[model samples]
Target: MRIGRTLPPAAAPLSVQEVLSGVAALFAGKRAVERFEAELRQHYAVPHAFLLSSGQAALAVILTALKRDRPGRDEVLIPAYTCYSVPAAVVRAGLRVRPCDIDPRTLDFDWERLEEALQGGRVLCAVATHLFGVPADVGRLKAAAARYGVAVVEDAAQAMGGEVNGSKVGTLGDVALFSLGRGKGLCTVSGGIILAGSGPVGSAIENIVATLPREGWGDALKALCYALALVVLVRPSLFWLPRALPFLGLGETVFNPGFALKRLGAFQAGLARGWREKLLRLREARLRHATFLERAGVAAAVPLHGAVPDLVRFPVLVGDPAQRARLIEMSAEQGLGVAAVYPEAVTRIPELQGALAGGAAPQAEQVARRIVSLPVHPLVTQRDLERIAALFRAEQGEQKGR
Candidate 1:
């Protein structure tokens, strides 16, 4: 059966203050970047927030700092089911990542397996991911890290306001990072922030962010595209992109930005600046839709609470891989953009194909097959979420009747 097309809420929104912020970027060497970074510190109560070119760059900067602690030692443990950027960041930092299995139930490493990875004694640092706002068992992982004296890097890119026991996710780890890209909890139009863990560690991030050259025209265009995308998100039927191509508007294609580029056109750059609070408002709305789905579920979902999840994609564990593939196909049939999240397990990726010590990442393999992601971005609506749950229910019904 073919699913119908539905449009989500806007990914970007505008307010008076936001408009003013964009206007200010007209001047060069402006503290607009620093202002945004300062807000992060105030919001998370962290001492530092080093804004960088991209999320991956933020990771590279942090990992490089961690790498300095152990020259010639470059083994970092990453969940087999994670973003391409995570592993890429490790490699860019001149380190090797050891892919580990994650608990299908929690979407994190079973601390036991993490311990086993550490037993190999190659682990210099660990990147713990709070995938889809479901907090990794940070407390337990913290205890384990303390025991092993391994520095835990919190990849809170997808977990902005996501919390555990009232504390924010970013505050829990030694060095926490967040991605402010489109569809994240807050869309900063291609910006990243690294939270300082220690005085020296935080200093390193500041130094890195300062040294990275600015992107002029690229940043402006990204801002405009994001803004346009947001404007269309509110009107599901009138979305400008659906009719634009064969999956061209279906997914993001142009996000290429480098260290140095000519200054952006004044108009485009002006459109991309400020408006942090307005973005937060939309992000909160998305979280509400997510809560509804979690509470009234066809498949179990993690409740993200009041905190903002950067990538509001909810992690779901289908009964099996076959079921997940069917569901993804079905969601698309409904005109929803479903994500594979992490389709191929870490051990399966060509980069680590032969280098892995273990034959297979059984836990990573299991979760990779079972886990599917749902759109929890600022654009998804209550109606959209209910439609999503209904689709899943229909899938189960079809299975039972068979």
Candidate 2:
């Protein structure tokens, strides 16, 4: 068991001042939520913006609204190797998941496979995710989607501050969502933002958002408690305590579709008072760490295309699964914060057996088995990066000897 300074796999810590602001917002009524929504609209330059309870809730709401325009189309296309929350949101919205294979190098949809998937007329939307803050080619995906009259939902949940050819990520697709949960580019205890154009689809989203209930005071208080704990324990010096507690499920990847759907609470919106500057600082730190890792040549880094990414975690492809496992074990023992992102592809998830509409995705399965992500959050230090590099070198040496 790690008893020393243990680094969290990923974190974007909330400050004490931010928590205090949230406490103050609790008494400010609906003004806090309105200000937050206005900020989001101005930043992303969208005609409509809404803050929801969580990223999954934002996605579920978007899917539901889009489905209203295309009642016959009940399928949502997604990456086969992405975060389980993507599929879970689709399921929550009462839609079938049609997973397309991803290109292992870029972790984006395989153009050929995506083209084939769009041939069928049952798809409602294709979700283009910017996984790990690496910007996916939404323009290419959108072009192909438009051919089938399918809408594109830019899942910028992990890439809020990212850019492609000078265009912000959130404005690329017909609709977009950004996650404000822990470890994301920005955090407000827990929340999500939706940006949409001023069209029929946007009107539908507004209607659905208006009907959703606001978060209750009880839940807002609980979120404040979590934020307080994060401020204290998200550091390397004290993270070990929480990491030792198995019940907290610190790094576990779960697929539960029963998450709550509601409007953002005033307290959480208050937590985002200075998100613009904070987001840029976090992005710069992540890019610096990722650059160091890339130069170290310890593993093959994931391709970022021509876009500038605000990576939350720097992902690398390890050729041998046994070697990857050993690296993760060594990192854990030394508090180096290495992680195997998702255990398996979406098609292999047990809960999604009958819910998926596509056939097998061989490349996505390969990526699931071989990919490992390293910590690139603002808290990561140069010493931490050195230790991580040393671990990778030692593991490579051992593999060669064996």
Candidate 3:
């Protein structure tokens, strides 16, 4: 075995048994996909669910569906500080994106800005993302969106197992999406699940899903390759190779809207079901790690908004941007999985300049500069946590002296 530190951002952690099960699923054909979808519906207690190629594709599908149902409305409101994919998916769905500022404290859309954006009648849908597995105030988001006759789409891409007031995160909005990509709460290599409530909108999404094309053999093969590669390269020790290779751009955020739209491959669908039971354990471990850091007072306390969030990553805010960079460097030197969440606010991304519905995103910009995330996945051990905590304190002390 390679002699190196073992902290990782996230891991699929597939055992020999799980690998064999996935191979068996390749032969099981469509049943594998159906079973996977069934498991998600049952787990989230939602009436309907559909598997797609990626979380971005799922967002595109939801936006497309909403636009089709409400042709007159063309704008989709989203938090300024979100994944670049959010705007990419909106553009792919042929809708304009209206940026809403986020509240620095909660790292979610600022209520005042969100309300003002919704009040404008052109908004068809408003997205509320459970950023980094921290639940966004979905109840309030829903109420605000409803007041303007807009649909609410929950982005649980980084937060599959979180709950808000005893209700699951995905079930809070009219429609919701969960990512099964590598490093997410759950890994299906490269896939996503859309859970919709049983109603007219849900029924429409179901119909659209039925009309969607099946995953091709090439796509399936690629997904299998991705699954295999994730198993090999997701370790903190191995991740450096990708980060060092400029072409790979492992940690750089880029805005690219051109991507394939396809159905979830059977191999990934099969692999996803085999890992269903592990989700709760992973969530618990992350929560424990996060709680430890919060109690230790290493950083600002994360506001939970009365919800037990299944955090995918524990975010820490360093008041100084340079210090945040230093913290990431210190953690990386120890092979700990720590990194900045986004390079900058989505609106600040150069490639996306033309698409923004101009709004000042002061809080979002600050978060981009100051926030760094620490891994709390199942792969993180208690000893690893101790080292991480100690390293963090040391860094903080050094920064203080400087």
Candidate 4:
């Protein structure tokens, strides 16, 4: 459940209308995809931006490209405390995933351990995750990468609007990838953007998308449901179907990872209405909600760059893993869902099995054990925030008592 005011599902009519003139039918419309890419390029101030089908696709493309830069030297350093998708992206790119430890305080890679991995493995590329929307301290990482001659493939899937200092995230690496798929700040229904540094990078991704599958009727139906869910998710109270619906096997909201609504001859009018009238309003409400949270001292705010997140999920630290588990259990009972994101521990994943196979990463271990994400998007309600903060405080008290 959210902790603050949520945006309405889709954009308002006038706002959608303004931007829908060139709206492409969901999948087949290369033009819309290209336009979205252009928007990303301008938004991120990058030389090239290639919109892909999924954020994982973008990461896979970047990793694959890096492998092209170094044949048979298949290794990419990933923080042990990120999404499974991070390492999975590496494997999908045909490179070995070498998980590394992260700094618990910063929610970023531990530079010393990372340096050790880069030097020891001689891996030419590294994946930087701005876990919980906080940009990793790129200065240290970037410096080390330069010295090691390692390319960075930023995993900005959880870091859409995250930034370092004043610099935008996607621009920090050789390739900055974003997620517009479901569960992201910008719900594009299903798609990802890869901000390329050169035309070749963009072209390579386009080539890959060509080989991917298209949406079928089931997928189309799923997309429609997701579209409706966006509206419902924004106002869960307004649209949450009765819990009884579950008995009918009619899941109230459908989230299909593979669904892609194509650019159809129809929906042009709706697109225009949504782009102009709907998105702007939704964006404002989300920003407003985010600002409220910041004011409430719930989480620190970062200056967002490309695709300013309408809502962000904050990685709130709770030091004790045992306490976190207790809180998760309690929150679930109260109908608040939570997730650990990824990496059982960079130390434990099979891919990073070779590097420091028996070694322990103090910082990464602490983070993996303690980090718990909370909803910071527009979907959060005021009551939700108060309850969450209260719960966090109460949890700390229990832990201290223990």
Candidate 4 lDDT: 0.57
In the range 143-212, model 2's lDDT, one tens digit per residue, is: 9999999999999999888887789989999999999998888988799999999999999999999999
Q: Which parts of model 2 are misplaced by more than 4 Å?
A: 304-308
Candidate 3's TM-score reads: 0.94
Go through the candidates in order and give the C-alpha RMSD of each one to the true structure: 4.2, 1.3, 2.3, 6.1
Q: Which model is ahead, 3 or 4, in terms of lDDT?
A: 3
Per-candidate TM-scores read 0.83, 0.98, 0.94, 0.75
Is 1 or 4 the stronger prediction by lDDT? 1
* Candidate 1 displacement at residue 144 in angstroms: 0.9
- The regions of model 1 sitting more than 4 angstroms off are 1-5, 8-20, 233-235, 238-280, 301-311, 352-359
Q: Give the TM-score of candidate 2.
A: 0.98
lDDT of 1 at 388: 84
Could you tell me the TM-score of candidate 1?
0.83
Model 3 C-alpha lDDT per residue in residues 14-103, reported as the tens digit of each score = 554555566678888889999988887888888998999899989988898888788899898999999888899998898888989998
| Residue-pair clashes per candidate | 7, 0, 0, 33
Steric clash pairs (candidate 3): none
Clashes of 4: 33
